[model samples]
Target: MLNGGPASDDHERLLLAIEAAGLDLWENDLVAGKATLPATRTFRELGYSREEVGDTLAFWLEIIHPDDRPAIENALVAYRDGRSDNYRAEFRLRARSGEWVWYANYGKVMSGSVETGLNRFIGVTFNINERKHREEELARINRLLSAQNQQLDQMNAHLEMLSGTDPLTGLFNRRAMNECLHRLTRSAECEAGVLFVDLDDFKKTNDIYGHDIGDILLCQVAQRLQSCISADDMIARFGGDEFVVLIHGRGEGGVRTILEAACERILNILGQPYVIGDLLLNACGSIGVACFPTHGTTVESLTKRADIALYRAKRQGRSLYRFFDSGMELDLYNRDSLEKALRAALKTRQLELRFQLQVDRNLRPIGAEALLRWHHPVRGLIGAMEFLPDAVASGLVHDIDNLVLENACATLGKWQHDPELRGLSLSVNITARAFDSPSIAPAILALLAKFGVPPEKLCLEITEQLETRSFVTANTAITHLREQGVRIALDDCGTGFSSLESLKSLSFDQVKIDGVFIRDINTNTVSQAIVAGLIGICRAMGLQVLAECVETPDQMEYLLEAGVDGFQGYLFGMPLPCAVLEAGVRDAPQSQRG
Candidate 1:
């Protein structure tokens, strides 16, 4: 076998395999300063004939990329000089078909001869263009994926914003309201303020104009509210017709200024009539302001107080703003005490039903109005006007209302039993607050039962303001009461919001001309004309009329000519004690019956 040792023979076989396996083999003679190459079956596969096999180093150098030749030559020189035993490089080369391909070339010296100061080194280079090309494609895809991931992150942020924002106005939604509140609480250094703004009669706008126009108005209001606040301040749509503004600052002045400015701007913008399609509409708003550390320390307390202020603002009037006031607490407390005393007064007979006599045109006693009097053991006597608002404020009007009704019924029952006063009707003043209670009618029925008084002898008088404001509710209550044979009287007509609309919507048995118009009827022609017009309207509606505050004889003469059905004022008598009323009814002449 033409072989050296096993290792040597293996080297020879490898060299032969490189030629037979269609590869290019080259040797550099370090001492001789020459280079040679042997092209094997690789030359044939590469379109190289046998004649091309006998080539020098220049022939192989031609295939290497121009840019990579220097580095490839340096690596090969270092390996052949024995500085490094291994040589590896990557380069671009032209293939046999005249196309450039990326390749990674790796080789090692086959052997070295040192005799005659001459060294020969053998190495082989194989094509790895496909592997290198695949790696480059993979790297390009990785870069693209990195850029796409960054863009997706930005898109997710935008989606999160859209989810939390109100679509119509680009403000925060209710969810954001809660989140901002919580965040404010968490920030120990942050001072928080809340301004609760409620649009006045917002539903009226929607009802008068179409909802589409209402939406435009709301959007406009939102823009004005937003513009009035600072960039750092946040405004959120708490719900329909309600917006909450949150600001971080030390002094409440900043919050107040912002809220007031917002309110003023909103009012100014909405105050001008809105022209929607063919109709013009007007609307306004009320703002309730509550500040942290002053109004409340916690989120719940702050919101509660803010809502309380909002309720007060609505009660005062629309298009106004109110800050949380500590005085409201004192008022609320006093109201609570009055309510408790009222409930106790009802049970303990501390309340009185005094009768005020009503006379006819001829100065003959016809009937009386039941006046409620509270006999406080310590506070002395208190009238309805003195504590009625307190009762209404404390939500205790219903208790006092039932007591008055019971007392009036009992007194009337006693008077009705007397032959002298058998025909006398009793008119009782009913507060508008009493009508708000759903149990008012049922309580009346109970009072009639407890006192054994007939419903026909009782007349419930309600104010004109109540009549105009709550026509439907008052009408329903009065209708149910009348079906039980009780009479209804429209009190204080010809003053304070009275109109024919009351007569058209509610059928009252009687109309009492207000004391204001009747007080000066003798001297004031306008007052006489008003009373005359009211009596005429009442007659037309088949309603009996009564004139209040009949003081002078000339006034009485005026009312008499006005065809007044009944009269009650100081002219008949100032409000009398029960004993005085009893004596008056007993001492009447036969022809002048009471």
Candidate 2:
């Protein structure tokens, strides 16, 4: 038999459901001041028995979290005092087996002695501990993500600074230069000059002391450059021995004085021997200056003009400075046009060569130097001096060398039977690119074999600048040629890299004193001293000495006294074609010929 009251049956069913759902249902008889509760359904789930029923509210209250018990009691007291009609709270409770769990309790309060069955308290409690733990874990991950983001920001800033800096020199690089130039252009400031400085024959430093020492020397140069420029000015390394200085000051005289002082200091500092490990060496720099507003209005225009001035300064003899002018641009454009034409000419065979006689001290034609002449259909005879530099700069000299070598060998075969020219030699000036060819030495040997000419009847003249690359392969090639009985001469020795060490290291058969120094030997004590020193070194090394640009008898007499073994200039004879030279040798009186 069962009680059939509707409200009591509904209440019993609700209690049974709460117990089955792993919750403990509690009821307080306020009039009796007693409390009763079912055994926790969670107890069965955790391998415990339902016989462990609670007798009073204190039994359950004892299992409430210690910190939350006082708040729960206070809230209960407020509800009992009629201060609140409903109660809701979240707090910690001990579940079966003494594990802590979070519980949410919500209920409606009923006043005492109600007549209707509806006047009864009701509430529910739920386990929410797993959801609370997941929330805490998500909060920790968010904090970690914030920390990573902050570190990334710092790293990005550092990378930006490093990108604009030259790693080796520790100065601003060309990329930084572009940014700074734009800023300067937008400013109202006037009178800024861009000086492009290049270390003269820097390749020689690398050859002599190795690239490690060259790197140290470049760092020292950067430090010196920083000291030369004012705080308001900027200096950036424009890649490999080239640096551009931006000076923000007024007055041409002041600029010149500052530039000269800077140049003199740089030369003087670098002139001192650089001591690396056990070796000591020296180097110098050439500066080309182009003043803003005076040279051009834009950075590109000014830099291009400065480069032209730099080229002219290097060509005229390095370790000096030159200012840019409008003529440099005109000359540059003309050369550019000529270079395009030259490239086309090589393909069309419009280029040709004519030989010039090389006379000995006795006025006998011992050799004929192969001189290049261009017979452009529209431009007539384009001289070697006019287009040779353009060819070299444009990297077309290799084509010209092959063309000339093939022609010269064929011409030598024709002259092989001539009695006066049978034993004579042919000298050719070798360019830097020509030596880079793996076939240059072999080509010359093949040419000699084809012509049935002796190796001693061929001479190769190279500038001292070409000797800067101490590449073992290049050295091996040159050594192989010299072993084959070819004579090598270092041309323009006095004004370029003419150090006693360089000469001894390269071991050339001849040293040609540059004509500029020889031209003023009688009047310039400095020129006389340099030539004497070089001649003395040449003689000591068993290398023959040749003086060039002898236009006066007094100059010839001075060079003769300076121990030069040979002279070649207008004073003796100009460079004449091979036919005229042979006729002069054949038709001249025997006294004049000898």
Candidate 2 structure quality by residue, lDDT tens digits, 1-594: 356888889988987887688665544554444444333543343344544534445555666789987777677666666687766666776766688777767666454433332234446666677887787688888788888888888888878887788899999988888788777666666767788889876766675557888898888888888987678888899888898888876556766576666667656765666666776656677778877677777778778888899887776778778888778778778888998999888988887776655555655556666778888989898887778887877778888887887777776766678876676667677765566666789988898798776777667777426544444445666777889988887777866553454575665777778888977788899988888888878878899887766788898777766677776777766667667766765775665443
Each model's lDDT comes to 0.74, 0.72
Candidate 1 worst ten-residue window by lDDT: 109-118
Question: Which prediction has the highest lDDT against the true structure?
Answer: 1
Where model 1 places Cα greater than 4 Å from the true spot, the runs are: 1-193, 197-244, 247-254, 264-286, 291-308, 325-329, 436-439, 442-446, 449-452, 467-469, 498-500
**Model 2 TM:** 0.70
Scored against the true structure, residue 411 in model 1 reaches a CA lDDT of: 82
Deviation in Å, model 1, residue 17 alpha carbon:
51
lDDT of each residue in 227-333, candidate 1, tens digit only = 76778888988767788888667455665675566557656764666665776666677777787767887778787777777767876756777788987666556
Q: How many clashing residue pairs, candidate 1?
A: 1
lDDT of model 2 at position 120 = 41
